[model samples]
Target: MQKKALIAMSGGVDSSVAAYLMAQKGYDCAGATLKLYDNPQCSQPGERACCTPSDTEVARNVAARLGMLYYVFPMQEEFRKNVIDKFASTYLNGGTPNPCIDCNRFLKFDALVKKAQELGIDYVVSGHYARVQKDPDTGRYLLKKGLDSTKDQSYVLYSMTQEQLAHILFPLGEYTKAEIRQIAQEQGFINADKPDSQDICFIPDGDYASFIEEYTGNSSAPGEFLDTDGRVLGKHKGHIHYTIGQRRGLGISAPQSLYVCGKSLQTNQVILGKKEDLMSSSCLVNDINLIPWDHLDGPVQCKVKTRYRQPEQPATIEQIEKDLLKVTFHEPQRAVTPGQAAVFYDGDTVLGGGTIVTEAQLK
Candidate 1:
């Protein structure tokens, strides 16, 4: 019997081509588009929102063209509870959260995989730009960066477990974005020329502060903007309106450029300082998921990426507690924000990652 696979088609070129590739590989393929959200308040007109009606239509058409069954899974409540609520609460606690990681952790790999198992599917496939390989010696699944370095998405997928990695497939891992687009165009996919969605699916306009206020039905109260020495520089609209390394819209007239260095929920203050003040030599990480090893017995040298878009920096990772890691950068890293993922990589292979909790100054 042929193996059955569930392909997650997002009505985008990458996912469309992913579905096509899996079908051609002789797998019994089915397509699913997750209907995550639809509130007008959450999205803007003319903005590309994931799981919208139009997106689903395109996905359905692609599935039909491939002669495979398609289904739309309603995941609005799950997305709200896991991704959106976490995003708002993280900001409320003075941390900047990455919702994409939460979505992949909870919805795609967890919920979607469960759904596929219920249907007796052997594997779940998607268009994520990352590769997963099984080590013949250890029989362990290894997650590696996609061949297309420019579009690699391994950082957001670090929380995947061994079981999830073993059962999931990323068909676009070996192909570049340009190659995926070309394949989609050649196959006459409707979304072949569709632009990639850049903004958050829920916050299409990119105004996160306004979305949080509206979603929670509570305004972020005004707070004091304090300098590094605890001197009041000015009044800020709200702490949620700022994040670490933000320089513009400070509403302060400083001789040198001022950036948001930190935020204090207890004091209801946003700390501003020079760019150097944002640098930190070490940071503590919680909720760690180690791929290469079960635990780090001692300090292991690897490159760490504090944010999704930033390049990885050389760091020494030490397992302080079972679920905690201390990452000390060889050189000071700037704006190691709390709530963002600290993904560690050894060359192209992903060692593991965790959520950043706090930063420590260089000794």
Candidate 2:
């Protein structure tokens, strides 16, 4: 009997191709699309969001073309609690949050994996640009960077536990973007030419402040923009409107350029500082997930990435507490933003990762 697999189809070319690949591999494949939200009537525009009713239609069409069973999983409540709420709360607390990571954690791996098990599926597959392999000696699954280094997504996936890695499949990990596109084109998939969704799917235009205001029904009233010394520079629309290291649109003209340094929830103030103030040599990360080894007994040299796209830098990772890691970078990293993930890598394999809580300034 062939092993059954549940393929998460997102109505995008990548995921549509994933479904095709899995079907061709002789797995009894079933395509599933997670409906995260309804058409949120944004005050800005009425155009349907990326994963809209039309997108679902496209996913179903692709599943039919692959001769597989299609199912739509209504995951709105879980998505709101796990992704949307966390996104708003992170910004409210003056930190940049990557909702895509949260979506993969709670929806794709956790929720969808559970759904797959309930259906007696042997594995849950997706189009993530990362690879999972098992170590021959330890018999443990290791998450590695995708073959296409430029499109590698291992940073967002570092939070995955060993068990989750054991059951998940990334069929596109070894394929270049061009190859995936060609596969979709050959299959005549409708989403072959679909433009990549750049903005936060919910906030299509990238106006996050407006989205938060409408979503939570809380008006983050305009507040004072303060310098690092506590002197008021100008008025900011709100703290949520700014992020660490943002320079432009401060609405304050000064002789020297200023960057958003910090935010004060107590005073409802946005702190501005010189560009030099954005560099940090150390950071504390909470809610860590260690891979390859259970926990680090001492400081270990590894390459660390403060943000997803930033090149990995030499660093020493130490397990400070049960759920915390202290990373000391060899060179000062710029804008090591809190609430973003700090993923550790040893060569191509993911060592571990955690949520950056605070960055320590160089003494």
Among all candidates shown, the one with the greatest lDDT: 1
Clashes of 2: 0
Report the Cα RMSD per candidate. Answer: 2.2, 2.6
Candidate 2 residue-wise lDDT, 1-363, digit = tens: 999999998778888998888888999999999989875542222243457667788999999998899999999999999999999999888789999999999999999999999999999999888999999998888999999998898998988988799889999999999999999999899889887655577787778899899889999889999988999888999889998999988899899999998887777998889988998989999878888988898999999998988999999999978878899999998988988999999999999898988533211
lDDT at 52, model 2? 66
Stretches > 4 Å off in candidate 2: 42-49, 359-363
lDDT of 1 by residue, 187-216 (tens): 999899898866688887789999999999
lDDT of 1: 0.91
Every candidate's lDDT: 0.91, 0.88
